[model samples]
Target: MTYELRDHTADVAVEATADTLSALFAAVADGLAAASAESVPDEGDRFEFEVAAEGREALLFDYLDRLIYERDVRLVLPADHRCAVVGPGEGDSGTGPSDPDEWRLTASARGVPLDAVAAREIKAVTYSEMALERRGDEWYAYVVFDV
Candidate 1:
């Protein structure tokens, strides 16, 4: 997986590419976490959270939003992301990922509280220029953060 910072009109954007959906999610999460902090500590508190969406685009949006919410509520700068994607998500019934059914993301992340690191104020994740798609053999994502 690879991620790079991109220039944005007023905020900051990140573009990531990976070989799998899980990797893609993790890469984007990594980008957001890095954008939110100057550096990630070697050790941190680990936590898990879940989010469900109707499609890949919304799933990606919600995933990033959840991380930011976690940061604000817990006062932490999250990193080391791991994600699992499931269609017909937990309690739902559907055909598959393309079924327009619920898709769930169960993510695990690690981070140190704000007091342990220098952090930037990232207010939220925006849909402006946001994207998630499969290109050839890789999955790509582009996201803008509202700073």
Candidate 2:
């Protein structure tokens, strides 16, 4: 997985890619960790979740929103993830948990201390021109969040 920060109208923009959706989400978590510049404790604190959306952009937004919510509400930082498409279909709608193109993600994350450095607070995931697609063997996504 890989992540890069870019200029955006919001607090920041993130671009991530991976061989699989799980890898992509994991990379996005690492990117979020990097954004905070905080050292996440390496402990086995696992969480399970499922999200569905009408399209790929919505799915991506939901994925990130879950991460942010976990951070804010649960203080969890994703360390590893495994996502698989379980449903059928194509494109965004096809790429979900219930759809034929659905994906199921199981992940392990570290817990951030309450006294950790405060970074930008992610308010919500945005659909302001988000993108998700596949290029050959890799999956790619671009996301913007309201801070």
Candidate 3:
């Protein structure tokens, strides 16, 4: 997975790509971590989260929102995640065993310390012109956050 940071009006734009949706989401989270300049601790607490969206765009928004929530609200910086979509029709959404519509993510993140000056706060994840697409064998996503 890989990501590039772009300038935005208010917040920041992140473009991420991976071989699969799950990897894409993970790359997005890593991008967020990089933006914050906070290292994801190798040893930390684990949490389980589930997000449902109307479609692909909303799904990506919700997924990123969950990660931001963990960071801002729960004060956790996730290092790894296992995500899978539940329910759907076909393509991004499927009736097969693995789909990319709805998602359940189990993540490991570092806990925020009381005197951590290096940690940066994220206000929220935005859906402003967010994009998710599949090209050849890779999956790509573009997102902007409201910091």
The number of the candidate with the highest lDDT is 1
Q: What is the C-alpha RMSD of each candidate to the true structure, in Å?
A: 3.6, 4.4, 4.4
- Model 2 TM-score is 0.72
Candidate 2 residue pairs in backbone clash: 56-92, 87-100, 87-101, 88-100, 88-101, 96-102, 96-103
- What's the lDDT of the predicted structure labeled candidate 3? 0.67
Write one digit per residue (lDDT tens) for candidate 3, span 16-88: 9999787787788777766665454455656766666667667777777777777666655655655664335
Q: Could you give candidate 1's per-residue lDDT for residues 1-147 as a string of tens digits?
A: 999988798899999999989899999999998888878887788999888888888999999999988988888888899998775634533334444467888889996788887888888999999988889999999999989
For all candidates in order, the CA lDDT equals 0.86, 0.63, 0.67
Candidate 2 at residue 3, lDDT?
Answer: 85
lDDT of 2 at 90: 37
Q: Where does candidate 1 clash, by residue pair?
A: none
Task: Please report, as a residue range, the 10-residue window in candidate 1 with the lowest summed lDDT.
Answer: 89-98
Q: If scored against the real structure, what TM-score would every candidate get?
A: 0.90, 0.72, 0.75
User: What does candidate 2's lDDT look like per residue over 1-147, in tens digits?
Assistant: 898876676566678999977677677666666665445555545676666655555566776777777877875555455444322353443333354555433444566543554455667767776777888999887776666
Q: How many backbone clashes does candidate 3 have?
A: 1
Q: Is candidate 1 or candidate 3 better by TM-score?
A: 1
Put the candidates in lDDT order, highest first: 1, 3, 2
